[model samples]
Target: MNPALRLPAAAVRTAGAVSPRLGAAVAMPMFAHVAKPRPVSDDDAPTMSLARGRTIRIPGIDRRGVDVAVYEWGRGPRTVVLSHGWLGRASQFSALVRELVAEGCRVVAFDAPAHGGSGGRRTYLPDWLATYAELQQRYGGFDAMVGHSFGGLATLVATAGEVEAARAVTIAAPADVDELFRGFQRMLGHSDAVSAGLRERFAARYFPGDPDPFSWLSTVRRPLPAGAPLLVVHDEGDRVVPFGESGRIAAANPGAAVLPTTGLGHNRILAADVVLDAVVEFVTAEVARHPVSPTTEAAAPLTSRAEPVGVS
Candidate 1:
């Protein structure tokens, strides 16, 4: 824990000594915190503006409706859903949106609650799952779903026999949902009691009837749709989520392709030309191909099956 947060960690520990539930009640709010808002980058501004007239009003964590900014491009038969990671926005997939559109795919990407232009302050995996549920209903079925980091895990959970999607791809996603909570506990330097309480209360609130919260929340526990091709992309050098996570996901979902890159870390991998190529290719593998324009062919994925992430 940071020196500044040590005091709070101690206080939570003291509270846990009395009752883990009590400590968790106090820690839940912080656990669901969203990072400081990030301005849409200049490169992504144009794509960001595309969501101006397209937005979804979904219930927030409190049940109050909130407007989530959604960006759409193209009008092809295949509809691909893009999910940005925690603290990430829709425009982060600008490069991907362009490619999928060029491949004649109707691209749909949204800013989750409490992130980017979406409303609210705190959000969790369930919040993201709910948003996707709403979209799945509206879209009827999705041809492909691509997500980064936290969004990656949520993507699989949402699509596991719930949403109708043909294929899935994840970038820098964590393997075990339980490990995510455990990692959070480590980050906050919480005591065992406080950490246990956090899971107990969280499970009670979000996963009623499921004694073990992550047993259902996990992708491994609920593998992707059978025969649904999955592409797991991860950078070996990622510090946020380990590279081994992709291995775990691949191992659980046999025949799943594992594309390992280096140096792109977590967020930056989203826009890498190689990552985009693998995703678009896998997403559109079944559909009849579209001809690439001269410009696109000229700038083909800079990295081969061997090289790493790029297009920065």
Candidate 2:
């Protein structure tokens, strides 16, 4: 723990001692909060400038509408959808965008509500999932879906349902909601009771009338679409999300491939040429083998040029 964050962590523990629900209340805001949104970097500017920008308003959190900022590149029939992580904008995918476009693929990416040029201040997983649903409807599905960190989980959740794509990719993504909740609990130094209460509130708010909210949110429980090939790109030295998470994701879905890199940490992995190349090659393999069309019906199995091995 950072020396600076210890005092606040202690305060959360004290609050939990007072009442579990109250402690949960204290942590919910931060857990659901989106930190300061990252602006487009200088390296990302040229690609972002080339994207045709637009907004699409959808039903959002807290009983409001969220105007999602959507960005697109290329006009090819082979479409790829990009999802940026929490506190990240679509611009983080600049390098990958250029690669996909150069291969004759159309790319669509969005700033989830409250991130980038979108609407609102706070956002959650449901909002991210909703954005995916909305974009899929408008664009008539995709050839591949790529997401980083939080967005990686979102892409997984999207594949579990109706968001049809020929292939999927996740970069440094957590495997389950429980790991994320536990990490948050550790950060706040909250008790088990507080953790339970937080889930209680989370379920009631986002998944009312549903039992086992976490089941719907877990990638293991609802593995990726059966036929679609999945590439789990994770850095061996990632600090933000554990490297082994990709292992979990791969295990849950048989035939998934792993692309392990070094020294990229969490965020830097997004800008790495190796990562971009692997992702583009994996994402476009379906197109090279078959047509760009991705139907709900089963298609040919996904085969990737990347090795299916992991880091030690």
Candidate 1 lowest-lDDT run of ten: 303-312
Q: Judged by lDDT, which candidate is best?
A: 2
List lDDT for all candidates, in order: 0.74, 0.78
Which candidate achieves the best TM-score against the true structure?
A: 2
Residue 139 in candidate 2, Cα distance off native in Å: 1.9
Candidate 2 lDDT, 1-312, residue by residue in tens: 979668877777788899999888877766776666787899999999999999887666654676889999999988899998878899999998988999999999999878899988767666766777677678776788899998898788777755667788999998878778877887778999998998887777666655665675678886775656889999999877889899999999998999999999989999898998898889878542212335532132211111111000
lDDT of 1 by residue, 259-300 (tens): 999889888898898998999899998833222233321122
**Runs of candidate 2 exceeding 4 Å displacement:** 287-312
Worst 10 residues of 2 by lDDT: 303-312
User: Model 1 off-target regions past 4 Å?
Assistant: 1-7, 10-26, 287-312
